[model samples]
Target: MNQDIELLAAYWTIAGDIYPMGPTEVSPFSFENRMEAAGQAGFKGIGLVHNGMMDTVDKIGYPAMTAILEKNGIKHVELEFLVDWYLSGERRRQSDKVRQELLEAAEALGARSIKIGPGIGQEIADVKLMAKEFRLLCQQAAEVGTNVVLEIMPFSNVRNIETALAIVERADQPNGGLLLDIWHLERGGIKFSEISKIPARFIKSIELNDAHKYAIEPLWMDTIHKRVLPGDGTFDVPAFIKAVQAAGYEGPWGLEVLSDTHRKLPLEQMANRAYESTISQFRK
Candidate 1:
């Protein structure tokens, strides 16, 4: 294994005994257990979903959470899924509430980044206004010493690398950047060569996962339930890893394997498989 290529187990990758897109989104496994499993699997970091993280923080407090992370050798923390950040009215109000919670947790835990995006299937009517809002959001995050990473999904309005690049470029904050997921990039038909066009500063984070050559109908369902581990499917994950590395992104690579089959595995197995498979791609 290349010790230099550290992996951050994305929330869903090791979220054992959870029904994704179901009524309950939080993991059944405790935070301490999650940290232990991730650490033992050789992960240097772990991503946490907002609701689950808030519940854990409320129960144990940020200090306790940080202690667990430190004890388990988890260095990088990613707090995520803040959507509706670019909208107005009641939607924006609700988003602000979640944003406040996520930002506070981020600052308290010294998290590396907070992920955000406009909701899937909700098209942006005013790209300029959205860019302005993203800039402001990034400014607020920068105040707390973290970066705000926007995930570009095929189901979302900022659906491709080009449109996502434009928003980040316009947002213009050093802490504002994009989250490039291999599943999204390949499923959305984005070429690997496009990775070169993005400046190093704009590539805030990268996620590694694989899938069948063809996407299932209603693409979101395919991503949520069918994603395979890196190198387990048709995606050229090794090439993708090299592309990102060549693009100058040195941050921890995220292993975001979201699948129903994966969620049913033992926590240790889930974490280990995710780490081993992703790290193997680097060796290629």
Candidate 2:
């Protein structure tokens, strides 16, 4: 049922993008406020940034967050992006530990998938090496009953759908799949045809964030710093959604807007605007 409907919500990271005026992304918003606002805004659910539940996930742990979500009727947390990709040595060990934490969070919070970026930079120069690395990640993810959603970010080595899919194919595990972000789609210059041709099996999870034209800089800065609402800019997002449907994707199509401008208003207003804009785009 990827096609026959519409679902949307404003990401807290967008709140992070906009900061203070956005969605109380840092401190003061509080869990009570966030859930209350989201419930009132007519959203299906939220795509949580793990850090948002810092008090619960970090301090009190997963079950507390799950109880909170269950108590509020917010059972659809789609993606959990674990952002500590570039760690090595003790930090690498910590990465695995943190990953376990995420899985626990998922089981506790009812998260469907966990997003994983395989670090950054030139280490991915060799395709085979990254593929093996991905397999290891998948094995770990499977243990926690969470599929590892491999995010193909512009700044990372597998910056496009093709490369990410290739790595997934080589990794040869059921738990490994693609997480498509539109900013990555355009920045990586991944063609629509390529996106359409991706096998149904590869795209386990997906994300929708939009962008305005960029002046060109490092890929790292672009993925986070320059994203807009899905339909507000030039991403051909509806067509992209159609491509996902055309390829048989049946997963959450969550909005991940990162506009610095949009966050100035109340988050409920922002969420409504994002939800309405995205729903309108898919109307055709």
- Best candidate (score: lDDT): 1
| Every model's TM-score | 0.97, 0.84
The sequence of per-residue lDDT tens digits that candidate 2 reaches over residues 1-284 is: 32455453534533433442234445345555566566565555676655565554565566666666676566567545554444457766866776666777666666667777755664454568667777876786677676777877666666766677778898889877888877777777887678776788888866676776763476555555566677767788878888888899876576776655665657567766776677676775
**CA displacement after TM-score superposition, residue 255 of candidate 2 (Å):** 1.0
- The lDDT of each candidate is 0.90, 0.66
Q: After superposing candidate 2, which stretches have Cα over 4 Å from the reference?
A: 1-10, 13-27, 58-61, 83-88
- Residue 199 of model 2 has an lDDT of 81
155-222: candidate 1 lDDT, tens digit per residue: 88888777888888988999999999999889988989899999999999889999988878988889
